[model samples]
Target: MKLGACYVAKDNELKPLREDAYFICNKEQTLDVVDGVGGWAAKGGDVGEYARQLMANVIIAVHEEYMLKRSVDLRRVLHETYFHTKVEGSLTSCILTFKASLLHAVNVRDNGDRPDMAMELVVRVEAGDIVVLGIDGLLDNMYPTKMEEILKRETKGQAGSVCLKKVAQQGMRCTTRLTSLHSLHSLKLQKRQD
Candidate 1:
């Protein structure tokens, strides 16, 4: 699989910090994203720092699992990472694991208002298939149809950059109320037998 990713940080006066983080492990065929709850900033927390630390812990967890020769279990990895993350803020996390011809997705949200819940999904994938994973900022600004159109026009490697640029342009045209931190990942499935 080939992965492309890009992020745009908000430049506004109110929220200059970007609280989203992403990691791609080519050897493990995994993609992970974490979006820190911006509300934490109101409580004197550094959401960006929490997000970065959470992601760093995730990398460590993945590496430990790889070194142990254990199968990559998306749910287990997320659980372990969350337990190990000693940050002060909450976050929403999504992890994608590619194994054989299947793609496994696990998402968890830990906002203070509601219970911490997780969702899991598995989908069959084929060579040449494109999978897009993004944070809420990008999803709120760009519709799926628009993203499909953009991806169709650009090569796999350039898709993430183009999408981020388009979203940044749109955000610039509109009010600055939109969150400045936008992150996206474009994954192109390469040759693999079923």
Candidate 2:
């Protein structure tokens, strides 16, 4: 497996903080992205703090699980990490694990309530397949065809940076839209044959 990642903060004066966080555990072939709920800022919360803490706890939980020789159960990991994260804001989380040519994904959107269950999915992948993960900043701004075109022009190692740059440019051009660019983060993973 080969992975590349990139992050860009929102280029706005009013909201200078970037509220997205990501984690990559190469040893366990796991990746996580958390987006802090910007609405919390209206309630006097530090929008980015909760996401940062949640990602930090996810790293700890993943390492602990690996050290204990436990299987990569994304649901358990999410549940463990969510409860352990005692921060003041809400967030949306996406966790992914790659094993034996299969990708396991768990996604949760916190609606100011305790997250009881997450949406889960498993998909089989093949060598040379590419998996892209990003927060809404990137997804909402760029079209699928545009993203595919950019990725198709880059090598595996360059995909992350190139995609981020292209997406950020697109977001800048669309600044007149209702939703200005939020923090943008992207992870590009390519399956390689051993």
Candidate 3:
């Protein structure tokens, strides 16, 4: 049974979609949700387009190859691409696979060793978990932790729409926080250099 969920959307002008998307499907008794990070398809790059094509083929291959085995291997679905002549920038993604309670995930990021900076979150998602997918325009400001708290507090038994409305109320706050974080990071980097 495919009980996994996924979401992807444009977060900024720097590659509106950033090539990240997630999906869940059954592979035998285990289920795997693959998170894909699309490469930069900037002014003269094909990362975005190629990433999508690569992912599509990979997903199909996974289903065909792993369905009978019932176990989802993260390494099997993930492969790294090296560039020789082109300046290739890659985005990061996270995938989670599970069976009843067993969970496994694969995460790839544009920023090395910084999975936390990316927007993908794979927690113990409930049947009631409200999955919100939007561009950085909406989330770049507010951190995921805050969003989770807001949703938990304001939308106990309400619908997803109501929860999202409450989240919207805090959009400005998110923007402020984003700016603050940016400033702080910059300052820290400057201090290191000094």
Candidate 4:
């Protein structure tokens, strides 16, 4: 399977990189995305840290699972993932894994909640299916019907890299516009907050 991934950040923003992160393991038949909620962003620390920690844990879990011959277990993997996150006391993040055509997700719960990924899910995949995983920056930009159309039309006509480029470009446009709006707010509030 071929996958494409990208993120866009404004020039010299407080956090140049957004909190959304992903991992692609073609060799292990796994794709993971983690959306970090308002952790340091709200607390005035490193705004991008929760995501990096979660992403690292997911990558290590994927590698460990890849070495085993048994079928993958999403629950077990997530349990191990929490081990990495809990060191910071709590984690406010969501995780999703796509293995082959199967989909498993653990929804985001705010800090202080139990780390229970009991939302059982199993899905079937059709031929030539392409999935777009992103944070609000990309998703808030495109409508569902439009996104489906992009996947259907592009995946059939272009290579994996080409399709991903198109999608990322579209996401970049969304974030750029969103950032402009945010910039106005940030500038206005800069003096007030201090």
Candidate 5:
């Protein structure tokens, strides 16, 4: 059974949608969100185009891995995207895989410690645990401390979706970037026992 309730969207801001891409493969029990960085936005580099191409490649990769009966690997996806994709700028992605009692998160960043004997971002999640993933654009605008408070306040009932939308909208409101350039995805990990 799937172990989460999730929502993904580009906030309704003034910007056009391009650089942010998200896909959920229910057969693979995985979800992926990718955000393109616009360091070359001023240099005629197309963040949106790169993000799209990369996302498509990621979907293919995920499908291939699934066919081979393998787990999702963020690092492999990153490498494949990098070598095959000709993007002017870089992007960050978070891949979440749910299998039974484990929720494995694979985040590709510039630098991070490798998963040693243990998984790098593995969590033994139960029902009612909320997991939010986004790019630096969103986090830069809203810190983790503020996020915790908002999540706590908004999740009193079936308000997880509402809370996430509010957070994404408010984050975009304070930032100079448009909502299209910003992506926010959230899910509450709960098992389906029925």
Candidate 6:
């Protein structure tokens, strides 16, 4: 399987890269955890650290169960574990393999917007089809029509990664501009705590 990912952040923002990620493996076992320490606490050193530790706990616990049954629904396991742990201001998440052919994605959000993912010009995905979880920053500039244009213009396969990387590069350029036009327009007001 091919892996594709992207993230954008404005200058003086609370979080640099949004504290989230995903990876594809040879086996049908994969999990992604995130620490959404909202507002000031996310910027605070101690609280940010606490959130990371909480995520680690969730991962370890889920990983143990995953080892037992490769078919376990990791997302549900993580949700149950987090609820049982009762860690304040922290949300646990997991994306596990259910079967050899099926791929499942699960997400839980506490206070912030869910993450956004775009599938463009890929033979695997269709046009005008967007899957957005709890993040909202990418949706402001991306609409149904706009997404269709992107999906149509992009090349299939490796082109998806290239397109996503271009987005990252374009966002990086925003940081260098004297005016905050690009950064301000692309990033959501809620995401920009600066």
Please tell me which predicted candidate would have the highest lDDT against the true structure.
Answer: 2
- Of 2 and 3, the candidate ranking higher by TM-score: 2
Model 5 RMSD vs true structure:
9.1
Question: Residue 40's C-alpha lDDT in candidate 4?
Answer: 48
Per-residue lDDT over 35-128 for candidate 6, one digit per residue giving the tens place of the 0 to 100 score: 3435546445333443455556556656666677645554455444444443344433334332444445544433454333211111133343
The alpha-carbon deviation from the true structure for residue 173 of candidate 3, after best TM-score superposition, in angstroms, is: 10
On the 0 to 100 scale, the lDDT of residue 37 in model 6 is 38
What is the TM-score of candidate 1? 0.79
**In each prediction, how many residue pairs overlap at the backbone (N, C-alpha, C within less than 3 A)?**
0, 0, 8, 0, 0, 6
lDDT of 5 by residue, 150-171 (tens): 8777765547546665676677
If scored against the real structure, what TM-score would every candidate get? Answer: 0.79, 0.82, 0.51, 0.69, 0.66, 0.50
**Model 3 Cα lDDT, one tens digit per residue, 93-146:** 334455464444444444343323323223454454454443333355567677
What is the lDDT for 48 in model 1?
81
lDDT (CA) per prediction = 0.68, 0.69, 0.41, 0.53, 0.59, 0.41
lDDT of each residue in 44-158, candidate 2, tens digit only: 8776877787788889888988999986787777767767767677666678889889988875544333334466678888998777777676676666566667777775686
Return the top candidate by TM-score.
2
Q: Give the TM-score of candidate 5.
A: 0.66
Worst 10 residues of 1 by lDDT: 185-194
Q: Which model is ahead, 3 or 5, in terms of TM-score?
A: 5
Local error of candidate 2 at residue 146 (angstroms): 1.3
Off by over 4 Å in 3: 1-18, 26-43, 80-89, 109-139, 153-176, 179-194
Residues 78-141 of candidate 1: C-alpha lDDT, one tens digit per residue? 7676666666776666778889998887655342222124566788999988887876667656
User: Where is model 4 more than 4 Å wrong at Cα?
Assistant: 86-94, 98-101, 156-194
Inter-residue clash pairs, candidate 3: 11-136, 19-38, 28-70, 92-108, 92-109, 93-108, 141-174, 142-174
